[model samples]
Target chain A: MWQEPRYQKETVRENPVEEVKKITFRPATDIYEMPDGFKLLLEMPSVDRETLKVYIKDNQLHIEGEKKKDVSDGKFLLQEIRDVAYERVFELGDDIDADSISARYEQGILEITLKKKEKEPVKEIKIQ
Target chain B: MYRPFPPFGSEFMKEFQQFREQLNELLKNVASGDVHLASDVMYPAVDVIEQDQQYVYVVELPGVKKEDVKLMVKDNSLVLEGERKEPEMGQDVQKIRGEIAYGKFQRTLPLPENADLDKIRAEYKNGVLLVHIDKKEETKPRLIDVQVQ
Candidate 1:
């Protein structure tokens, strides 16, 4: 029980070092395919909307942010968990138009909308 | 002092109504998650045992690295503090949903009088922290035998 706090401290101190390493975060995401686009829902706790960064990179979508600590100074009767920085990535499909992707964060959830690319016209074929 | 219609009875009643509304608002704030407390954190299961001349404590902290944890026996209390860092995100992150919990946390437990101050050893393996404490020699119980006719 006591070591839980130590775990939290080390995580905070080593965050800068982790940035250079390859790490994977398991974030629950829901994807919905519609006629016009795809909708994605992401959950992130203790993260401020302004601190989150979402973008597409090399056919993959990336989400990263730093969650600020909620602990106050000069007092503590008990503590068990701490909020830390997080980053997540997702692969985009070929049909998705990268240029038309949009995202919104509200109530600790991130919702992303990706429009599908328009299909090219097909010419009629005649057989002799 | 029995005058002025009970000191503006209607006015006093209006103020009392407003006070009740404010009290309800305060209760709402207290019930919300916005209030942060140590109890709000997820606590790993733990068990402590005392046998013969030693005290043993086992803490289960799955999905947490040993290096990220800190254990300290201070004064008459055992303080445990650590943070569970969120894993890095991959290149493609469409959306995020359902965050259970990831962050810094601390828990402190008071030690009993019979607890040994010295001869303490701690080991962490398989996401469990085991601390062995040897009680003071003077505190150990002595077996006594009596022969009856």
Candidate 2:
């Protein structure tokens, strides 16, 4: 049996139930293989190139940023989304040369190119 | 001495407890995310479609910059991860209601064998991420001519 509520309620409740947050926001990215290196495209909308931070830590690439927040007075009919902060970590492989990692942000996309690390030569010793 | 049903009853309760434990674990997995993981799924509603000619993915990420998104091919899977945050709500006195999920999210999708990962292209316009995986030219079937007998 289904019972419908009699009236539509618009008043906001003081004690709202806390729902589990879904984990989804890591930026939408694309990886391409070029002749020189692998190109990683990151989509970070509304983030300024200067404000964005990118670094490699513990063999993982971490990206952090924050959206601009406003605190002005305004009448609202309806509000849905909440203020957000961003952080993402990517585990890098041994083949990636940390020293050769280079990143550039353009048009809301962070392009990171990971150059292949050169193999080190092994030396042989002669026993006299 | 009537102890026939006691053994069966104990087993049923044990099974029930195990079921409850599994349910709790599942719930915690959904809720026990860090601040960043929560925002990823809460922000965008995305759709991934694989067709005969191309692999198309559509992501609805409003107010997010293109540079903020990071797509990767790790372990033969395509991972879509990003963050979408809403600006602070102003200083107004009002009763608060239900709030949906927010924070960071990571969605990894497996790629098909025919997906031309080498020639992938993506564009974001009007708060939508459109990614196109072009099929390899050699993989496209060509029509053959047959002489009249």
Candidate 3:
């Protein structure tokens, strides 16, 4: 079995203001390892682009977004779809280039690509 | 992705397609450990809302196009069918974490007695599919007024 890379485990965080509690669901995501970097596909339907935030802080990848309410006037008969906010956290490793992270959200899917850092070669010391 | 009781009714319990849906959903509940098993069966989450003259059914289908979804009304039931095409996998790509339920899924619900199948309409937006089912005028509730004698 191929072991997942070190940058896989994620931890959710709370907003700076700790007033009323907000529900945060871990967005269902797919992570794939490419020859050059890693790609993450997340499901976040009904989320607006302006409300989405993706950034890296303290070597942790943070993703947070707000979903707009589309049908607020009607009474819900079957409420399987809850219009809740979403958040995700991922710890980044030295191999990852935090500056190169690129993301795109379309049709409710957010795709993020993280490029890996080039490995450095070790040099041997010469004795005179 | 597991929720509280699914609330699936007896209508779903009686059909072979229901069995497939259950298996697909069960695999999704255990998808973190068994991704391959979860393929081909994802109960796309949905919500059905009631309006004055129509019933609206909404389903979240991220990464799916309108052409990939099919809506049908028959035998007093409404059926939703769709497929999420597998992402193109280059020869060098390797899966590290697979959690999104991919592939085909089907859901059927008993239509209201007042449903007018002829006027059903569907629209896709931001990964959400909305199907508006206009209720027959006879089936819609109307308030009656009586003049005081």
lDDT of each: 0.59, 0.55, 0.78
lDDT of 1 at A83: 42
lDDT of model 3 at residue B46? 82
lDDT of 2 by residue, B121-146 (tens): 88876456767776665645788998
Greater-DockQ candidate between 1 and 2: 1
Please say which candidate is ahead in lDDT: 2 or 3: 3
Best of the candidates, lDDT = 3
Model 3, position A77, has a per-residue lDDT of 79
Q: Which candidate is the best by TM-score?
A: 3
Question: What lDDT is reached at residue A113 by model 2?
Answer: 73
Interface alpha-carbon RMSD, every candidate: 13.5, 19.0, 4.2
Task: Report the poorest 10 consecutive residues by lDDT, candidate 2 chain B.
Answer: B31-40
Q: For all candidates listed, what's the TM-score of chain B alone? A: 0.59, 0.55, 0.65
* Alpha-carbon runs more than 4 Å astray in model 1: A1-25, B1-149
Any runs in candidate 2 off by more than 4 Å, and if so which?
A: A1-36, A48-50, A70-80, A106-109, A120-128, B1-149
lDDT of 1 by residue, A7-86 (tens): 12112223564453322233345565567777766545445456689898778888776554332232222333334455
Candidate 3 per-residue C-alpha lDDT over A11-107 given as tens digits, one digit per residue, 9 for 90 to 100: 2335444443445666778889988899989889989678799998878888889777667668787888765567777777778998899999888
